[model samples]
Target: MKISCSISFEQGLGERLMFFKRRIEKKTYDKSSKKPVIKSSICNGEQVAGFKDIATGAFEEIMLIKNQDDLVEFKEIYGISEEIEKIY
Candidate 1:
């Protein structure tokens, strides 16, 4: 499954890759750069609908932040254009 999500970089690059499991796991960050590095991976057979924080550079999963208040805030800040398509 490949899910496409619109991520706001704010001050980072675009089209960066990241990994995904049933939920996101650790061990994906670059020590030298001190930023989250994708290393060209998408685990759990699903494209994650999320984004990285420009300041922290951490990849965030949409499913993890599904709270009503947070979702509304995030949608207002980042918009709700990102979509995840399940693979059959």
Candidate 2:
């Protein structure tokens, strides 16, 4: 799963994490029309996997990959990849 993020400064549980934003499209049923429709919106910076939850069917969550320090855990769980560092 590839995501785009710019510089981020935050505090608390998601502090060490850098901020990232991405625009996404979503599908939902319209109550008034009683039909399915696609809606597009922007998902703001959040916990690393936050977008994964929002993206839904657009992607399957393999591992809840995060910052550079998580590389060891990511490697342990998902195995080695040369491009892993690019995520942070």
Candidate 3:
């Protein structure tokens, strides 16, 4: 099954990694200073895929929805409690 998630960040890559480290309960590191720095990964039970960009530092996962209502249904099913300010 294809699934998508959106993530937003207020700081740079370093801060974003820290956020995900806490949210997904995973290990993260600060390597933003390196050239061609590695960013986060989006994955399912099978494998890692891709991620979405939010702002300068923020990011959101992008998934293909069957319809407009599908997006709403996903939000409900996942129990996304935060208020998501959508852009386009």
Task: Report RMSD (Å) for each prediction in the order shown.
Answer: 18.5, 18.2, 18.8
Residue lDDT tens for model 2, 1-88: 9999777667788765544544333323223332211222246322232112223333223334355454344444433333431212
Which parts of model 1 are misplaced by more than 4 Å? 1-45, 64-88
List of clashing residue pairs for candidate 3:
5-61, 6-60, 6-61, 7-59, 7-60, 9-58
Off by more than 4 A, model 2: 1-42, 47-58, 85-88
- CA shift at 71, candidate 2, in angstroms? 3.4
lDDT digits (tens) for residues 1-88 of candidate 3: 9999977665765554234522322222223421111123344222111132323544334344555554554445444434444332
The lowest-lDDT stretch of 10 consecutive residues in candidate 2 is 45-54
TM-score between candidate 3 and the true structure = 0.26
Winner by lDDT between candidate 3 and candidate 1: 1
Q: What local lDDT score does residue 56 receive in model 2, on the 0 to 100 scale?
A: 36
**Evaluation by TM-score, superior candidate among 1 and 2:** 2
